[model samples]
Target: MHQEGTRLPNEPVLKQKHKKRPIKTLFLEADEDHVAYQDSTNRFMKLVYVHEGYDLTQPRHQLINPHYFTGNYPGTDNEELWTEVLDYIDANYQPEQVYLSGDGAKWIKNGAAFIPHCTFILDRFHLRKYCKRAAVGIAGLDRTLYQWVLPGQMKFIRDYFTVRFNDLTVTASQLQSLKQAEKYLTNNVSAIKDNGLTAYHGCSAEGHISHYLSRRLSSRPLGWSSAGAQGVARTRIFQLNGGNITRFLQAEQRQASKQAKVTKLDRRLHFK
Candidate 1:
């Protein structure tokens, strides 16, 4: 955890104590999976961070597990879990900017509140799903219209809101649904504008969740133990974040070097 935080030097610390360096954005996504244990159910929530444009040479993360906490199935409140994850990030990876993207989940929304300065964007694909569903309800679910209008309407809705979001209100019958969609675009309006809505912007986070986590764990109805689930989830995250077997070996080498130096110092001090 300490190493994670040290990966990016804090601005205040750098300015006052150490020289400031560039801080990259951390793209984060989280989801909960229901795993059945022999006696009780375990709700395993996995959180992953992908440093923007991370490559094999410049690895940004040392650990890649979703911070896991145990709770009952279909639990109502996840404040504690969110708090723990946020605290972990705050302590270890003091990111200059955090970009969170995910499906509309209550816990995800609540988790954003903990990181006040972090920018939040909705998963673009998920946003399109909502738009398609709404359009289908209005335009009827005919196969041809579903295919044509869904993509076109999604683009239209995104553009329309981009220009006139502030002027709009929740007039749809499903007010709750509309609000959830609005939160993503409206929460960080300037960031959305600056970042733009190109295919590359929001899709990476969604792809990470879909390809790395959901496809393997949540695709089917399976159960997991809390410890086992977290361990596996973390391994997957590390692999996705470019923390492969070679990186682990490199980290091990660095740790051994540091330990050996400390041991030599101790022996010298004892002799003196």
Candidate 2:
């Protein structure tokens, strides 16, 4: 936020339910192996990967794998990354329209703004999930809630939550969820309204992020150093892109060998 070109932050970190705790988690004590106080951007890790697919059921992320950035995630890196993706798309394919979908994160929105003629869609998966969590909280007091929202009774379900919210009967958890939903909706009201009225495809980035990045880097009891995390993330992304992992390993080995020789020369000069 202190940087020159940073637009005002619009992403909600306040109520985000993430695998790694909030940025405040960076304050803890760490043993010699790891660093204390981790944020969304930095972690150390490793991975061994196999191929993944984007089938007919979930095809939006077919061409590109999730690109992981380690250490600090800066806007410059994001801009350059998005530019590379766009250039790749333009080089190989013809498209009638290009639409960008994300979790209403400020960085995602900011990046989308730079692309010419990009249509921004608030990801349906997250929108629905947050609304559902909020709705359940709103109706937590209703014993007969199961009967109130059947497959064809979505309108009733929506109204049920609305009425409960108005009545001030929501539980604490529901209140937080409601706040999240409201902020998300308020921030992207136009998108929410249009989404309700229009027919559009669902987004699979959430699932993709979980499968490709979060599972490997953020979830469970695992922790990461920035370099190890980035090295594995790069390798995973390469595998997803249909690149040869063996070749990548070989290149890394050559680079490492050259760097080791340089370090050896430096040590000899220092000792002399």
Candidate 3:
């Protein structure tokens, strides 16, 4: 019997290149608060990840992932919590770019250093909240000014303040108020600029936090178990990532099938 050498197919093999998935930029918002437990205290850190170009018409806005870390609030070692959270993000998502928004907390600023590559933005609504409180408390301004300025009236307020802040020679009281507002604005200028374009009242991140986490946690004076709190927070993140869970699952399944097929083929060719 003549042994025939196997020849590769003569037909032009079409190498269909897989199109690269578009790079997604994620907006990350995080906050840590102490949650009371029955016998002890738990510090819960929540992260909300939002991607650009995600369809908002779905049930939840395009939340990519939600992560929660809970532990006993270590006075000075809380930074470790931030490090763990950053490591989780880096491992799971591998996001192209991250934009962080948060209330002006010292821990938030300090923790952010862990993810130095991320674009840190202050929570704009928090900035306005501080400004309004200062306006009323220190400047002796009325509710009307706060209401108007908290909305998209920042430009008008800034212009008005520009003239007013200059004209009124810096008195002790005025100086105090100006200093307060200045500090808040200086720290949160980027968040304000990014959010000011919107006609809405509050920062989107703040709204998400209130709706998703705060409403449930702050509804009544209640204690939560560390595991239970972490579970709920994690679930909320998945919910916010929208209905894309199905798509993600489907993609994962397809990849697994493809990998399995390759493995099976390799085994067949190499079998003794």
Candidate 4:
């Protein structure tokens, strides 16, 4: 068992480095799960993945060779996570382009700067959310917002909201909602436009969070220590990546045994 506050090292799922190959397009998606610590405070466990588009044969489209990284990373560690992702890309496949989809979080966008030939695409979930909230009063407004987005005419939506917010008749609550939606749209203008690009595949970060992180970490009634949470998350990802937990454990045991014997031999030689 890990001591309280201890964090397990973030380990990659691959035992051996990927054999380099060429891929025309790669998709990267990221999201975070808010989990409760034992003391009741919450921490965001961020998850990021890279895949070779999707497998259409599956009833539900499946990612092809998705590898994940998860942790309660903050500040510099967040950069490290993205760096590791870039390293993985460089080591494995030579992709002509990489599309990163997320909710326009600053950390997620930072990845665009770190990786070459990377473009940021805002996920539809957050876009729809802001559109709904901003369109609370008008019937069909949500649909209208999405329509404008589809054709890449974000300025129409912005101008419409700006005109409405300027009206003295609008309520304070309505104005607040409009301002928030506008802010989100403005900050992610490039990402929003990139969504229409043919190379961009849709994002399933939320679904992944539910399946990979929330199922064990937050969906339950239990609170976890820092170490326990990270451990469970890593182990879950390992299994999802087709790792056999039993084999991994047995390998770890053998490695530990060898290390122990080496230590013992060195101590005996030193005493003599």
**Candidates' lDDT values, in order?**
0.49, 0.45, 0.54, 0.81
Compare candidates 2 and 3 on lDDT and give the better one: 3
What tens-digit string does per-residue lDDT give for candidate 4 at 1-272? Answer: 33311333334345585578998999899999889999988988889999998887898888988888787777733788887788878888899999999888888888877888998899998888888877867877888887786557877987888788878888889888888888887777778877778767689999999998998889988888878887788777756666666666677779899999999999999999
What is the descending lDDT order? 4, 3, 1, 2
User: Can you write out model 3's per-residue Cα lDDT over 84-141, one digit (the tens) per residue?
Assistant: 6665555445556666667766666666566645656666557656666456434555
Q: What's the CA error at residue 26 for candidate 3, in Å?
A: 2.4
Show where candidate 2 strays beyond 4 Å: 1-72, 75-77, 140-174, 193-200, 249-272
Candidate 1 wrongly placed segments (more than 4 Å) = 1-20, 24-26, 32-44, 53-97, 138-200, 238-272
lDDT of 2 by residue, 94-196 (tens): 4444455666665566545755555566665665655566556444533243333212244564565577577666677767766665555556655444344
> Residue 202 of candidate 2: its Cα lDDT?
41
Clash pairs of candidate 1?
5-92, 35-224, 36-223, 65-234
Clash pairs for candidate 4: none
Best by TM-score: 4
Tell me the lDDT of model 2 at 41: 43
Clashes per prediction?
4, 6, 1, 0
What's model 1's TM-score? 0.47
The top-ranked prediction according to lDDT is 4
- Global fold similarity of model 3 (TM-score): 0.51
List ranges where model 3 is wrong by over 4 Å. 1-24, 33-54, 57-60, 65-73, 93-96, 137-179, 194-204, 223-272
